[model samples]
Target: MSSKELTDKLVAAIKSGKYDAIICNYPNGDMVGHTGVYEAAVKACEAVDECIGRVVEAIKEVDGQLLITADHGNAEMMIDPETGGVHTAHTSLPVPLIYVGNKAISLKEGGKLSDLAPTMLALSDLDIPADMSGQVLYS
Candidate 1:
């Protein structure tokens, strides 16, 4: 879906309050980055950022919190240092975990994707399942 559509849905969901939580993933960056088209990739990233800004505003209106993260790094590193060409492979680099709103969680560096679930549960005061190996990212 387009970033605008994603933003509209998320804003509606947040405003509706029908669900306790929601996860909105913007695929533009990742989808466009794969083509190695620099301009398109940049635009895709910008679109995602714009959507994020809108979503943040919507969530704030509801006094809700937000957790922003990515499954992996892509458009963030668009060029290769050696060949000076577009880098298409996914990087091993860590993705940022941004917490927004009044219920912001304290972040610890060196966190992995696995840490997200436990951290979300902890933030919501929900019990972390024993079978899950991931630990909370915050103190």
Candidate 2:
């Protein structure tokens, strides 16, 4: 589905006041990015940016928190510096881990995806399971 359709649905769902947590993925950034078309990838990124702005506004309106992150890095390294050609491979760069509306939270260095679960549970005032190996980033 297009990013617009997905974004619209996400906004609607957030405004409905029914869900405690929601996950929205915008695959265009990676999917179009992998095609090695620079212009199309730029447009795809712009669309995702607009969608994220909309979602952030919706979350703030409902006094809800937002945890924004990515599974991996794709568009960050678009072109080879030496070759000057389109590079189509995921990078080892660290993906962003943003926490909106949660001023008490602060991420330390060496954070991994496994830490997300514990951090999320802590943010919601829930207990982290003993078996979970991730450390909570915030109280």
Model 2, range 6-124, lDDT digits (tens) per residue? 99999999999999888778998789778888888899999999999999999899989988888788887789778999888776788888888846666665678889888888888
**Relative to the unseen true structure, what is the C-alpha lDDT of residue 96 in candidate 2, on a scale of 0 to 100?**
82
> Each model's C-alpha lDDT?
0.85, 0.85
- Cα TM-score per model: 0.94, 0.91
In candidate 1, what are the lDDT values of residues 31-120, reduced to their tens digit?
A: 886888889988998888888999989978998888898889888778988999989877778889898867645789888888889988
Regions of model 1 farther than 4 Å from truth? none
What is the TM-score (0 to 1) of candidate 2?
Answer: 0.91
By summed lDDT, the worst window of 10 consecutive residues in model 1 runs over 98-107
lDDT of 1 at 24: 74
Which of the numbered candidates is closest to the native, going by highest TM-score?
A: 1
